[model samples]
Target: MVDRKKSPKKTRNLEESRKEILEAAFWEIFTRSFQGVSVDDIVGKTSLTKGAFYHQFPTKLDLGYALVDEVIKPMTYSRWIDPLKEYENPIEGILAQLKNLIGKAKPSELRYGCPLNNLVQEMAPVDKGFKERLENALNYWIDGMEKELKRAKEGGYLKKDVNTRQAAHFVVMAHEGFYGMLKALDDPKAFDALYDSLKRYFATIRS
Candidate 1:
């Protein structure tokens, strides 16, 4: 016998269960490399059974890909890409965004560094799927910065000679390098030097 009321509630419960599994899997993969973590590790963190886990994520690779597409991509876009639209001055916008990131950063965030970068470093070399997906996200970031810098150039904020493509590449590479170095050194003073170096480099492109 089909109970109509029970069906909707069961569906909600199923979705909620799947969300929990994904969230758990996200953190597990975030802290532990894709190759380092196991299906058992993810399942152990949740109350769900193996069948329930398999129902939501048929395989670990599927879950990893979902985490990259659904979890990481949206996050990178919102934090790193969206805010750039707000500033008339690309340099100011970039610096303001960096300051905001530095302000909100916690010890765990510092320790873990950037998730996109971490995954690219860990999984990109070994897995074709991971490499392509990660590169897509990275390209999105680079393209966004390049677009903003070109806008700035058109607005006469930057020198005509500036190469937006190379400048955009330098911005992302510097930001990632700063975070990785900070995490490695475990010193707050490292941020001051990083910021100073970035500002000095950015100075060269300004009109």
Candidate 2:
């Protein structure tokens, strides 16, 4: 018979180790770019040895994909998707979300830009596996915005003729473009202008 107490503790410890490895990999890849960061760099950030790291991730590519699937996807969902649910005004919710993101930004975030956008630009053209996974994450962002916009239109927050598909596409493009420019210029103040532009764009969508 299984010892229920010991078995649950063992499972919890294993899961914790797996999460620790992914957390290490996430920051390493974010700072160095996924292609530039080696497995050794990630292991160096954690207490786990090479063997323990390999036991959890099996290979570098697996760790990268897990970072995309488990860590990054959930972060984006919480930041960009979850708050939109049950919101009375899609435009206000979106604008508030952007402002919240900007409020939390640091100099380092502006310098490195978003990890998702970084991978999309660097790996999409050359790497199929990375491209597919990155695209899935991007689609999740776009689709969530598209859904909220559609709800707003249906509920009379948007103009009767507003095209939600285009609106959603514009939002994703603007955000990605803003982050790319911010990273290239290493200027957090650039968000002020971008925020103003975004506000004007949101104003146009109001009923």
Candidate 3:
């Protein structure tokens, strides 16, 4: 008889458990922006018991931070900022990534919108904790992009007139506005048109 190996399910128990909680937490966030969501929604969605919820998150806010720390933060760097570091032509890489963002955004999401933006719009002004979290995420994104733009400028890829910080502001603001309009209209044509226009803007830079 051949010896059988045990599944490392035992070893992965905590990791798996954490992932489950985070996945449920992410869904809760996506479905319900900060002011409107509850811990019960997350707990009810998971297979684990209510005790499991407590073990992972003492309160819903803790879970919110975890979602940012575990999921959103890494993606912000990888999906938008850090990738530019590797490209021979960083501006093209950046523009391609912007197009990729729209491509990756689900039709439903385009109809409903970005969860983080939703949270910022709904909670930031009145809720200090939420404002801090939203600001942290937003700053991380803007700072990273600005860093890339600075790098591209130093390489003589962009116009001397291109202000990296201002460009970063314009990109983020335009992205938020595009998504907002996309959600309101439930149309990809608007997104495509705006993004194409942005691509043309990129083309106007020094070559």
Candidate 4:
């Protein structure tokens, strides 16, 4: 029976719809390269029609930029900065935050390299827009790491000989390395090894 008055369940606004499409694009780009995906790949994840897609994102390039702006950049900021900003002991703070992620991470998630990293590696080289956006995201990562390292230095947790920039880069780089290792082996133990090794490294640098 058709209702006389159709209920307005309501739909997302432009910004909200844009965010949804970008998130779908993030997942699609993670599983495949940017060039490998299409507007259909993104809209497929949503209930909205192609009209909605074009209304929010006129091109894949617009979606790619928004993907980095919303997802990648903030994720990088959180992973590499939040611990440092919130905790007094920079080194242990970083390690503890990582362990917290391990504690909560679903077993299924352990099998993929970070979705953002996957897209960054695959799309950064092939698309100029992606390349710029990826760099913007990575810069947030590097800056966050540098901030933590600076805190460690000031707190006397690191040796004067330690180059903060280098140390920070190493930390972020090693994290990606561990995630890549996890994807290849699908072993939480590999992540365990990484956590343990970083813990030991932090112990050495502790005040």
lDDT of every predicted structure (CA atoms) = 0.85, 0.85, 0.76, 0.76
Which candidate would rank higher by TM-score, 1 or 4? 1
Mind giving the per-residue lDDT tens digits that candidate 2 earns over 134-173? Answer: 9999888888889999999998988988999899889988
**Cα displacement (Å) at residue 54, model 1:** 1.6
Q: For candidate 1, give the lDDT of residue 94.
A: 87
Candidate of highest TM-score: 2
User: Which stretches of model 1 miss by more than 4 angstroms?
Assistant: 1-15
Show where candidate 3 strays beyond 4 Å: 1-12, 104-106, 203-207
Please provide, for model 4 over 66-98, each residue's C-alpha lDDT reduced to its tens digit, 9 standing for 90 to 100: 878887789767776785677767887777767
Relative to the unseen true structure, what is the Cα RMSD of model 2?
A: 1.9
Instruction: Note the residue pairs that clash in candidate 2.
Output: none
Candidate 2, run of 10 with poorest lDDT: 101-110
TM-score of 2: 0.91
Residue-by-residue lDDT tens digits, candidate 1, 41-147: 99899989988989988988888888888888888778876887888887888888887896357766788778888899998998898898998888888998899
Q: Which candidate should be chosen as best, given lDDT against the real structure?
A: 1
Q: List the residue pairs that clash in candidate 4.
A: none
Question: How close to the true structure is residue 180 of candidate 3, measured as C-alpha lDDT?
Answer: 86
